[model samples]
Target: MSRPRDLYDDYTPSQQMTDAIKAWEDIVEQEKEVRRAAREAIAAELRDARVERDGVEHRVSQEAVARYVPWSEATVLGIAREYKVPGVRQAKKKAADAG
Candidate 1:
């Protein structure tokens, strides 16, 4: 095994290094495009998600959506707001009642 080299040393970028960086940049751009599409699809579904309560259909709560998506509730709300998802709102927490 080779010993670690000093990372702070001033060095010229080699052709291999430059090519690899360009390749990684292209890959990252493609990943961003795919992620954008996925977010839009997920947001659309989340916006339309519904549940039956008292024999009437209602939009699922953002908290529930967050749990189902396995993302933070705030993150889910952020995406909803970004995508203009309808019927989703930030929930207000109520303090416990004092006896």
Candidate 2:
């Protein structure tokens, strides 16, 4: 098989080589920035997903939730709402119901 072209082939370091190196450096820096941004975006999404998962767990028993998996997201959500987790609080009911 033919060898792939090396962008930075061994050559006498000259002004042209220097310029090429600088250009390559810029590309590398730009790629690093792009990777960083993608990582940040993924991290943000993971944080949001974890928060959402916690909210569902808060509403439903954490242990029971595992059994309901493989269900549709909406169905799982419905089940979570239907089966309240113990010890989590909701808004206080009206005093009339407090008797």
Q: Which lDDT tens digits does candidate 2 get at residues 1-99?
A: 999988876656789889999999999999999866654443333233332442553233333343544445454444445443232245466889797
TM match of model 2 to true structure: 0.37
Q: Candidate 1: which stretches are off by over 4 Å?
A: 1-12, 88-99
Pull out the clashing pairs in model 1.
Answer: none
lDDT of 2 at 7: 80
**Candidate 1 per-residue lDDT over residues 8-91, each given as its tens digit:** 678789999999999999999999998788678668778787777669677776677777765688887788889988754544
Clashes of 1: 0
Q: Estimate each model's TM-score.
A: 0.62, 0.37
In model 2, where do residues sit more than 4 Å from their true spots?
Answer: 1-12, 50-99
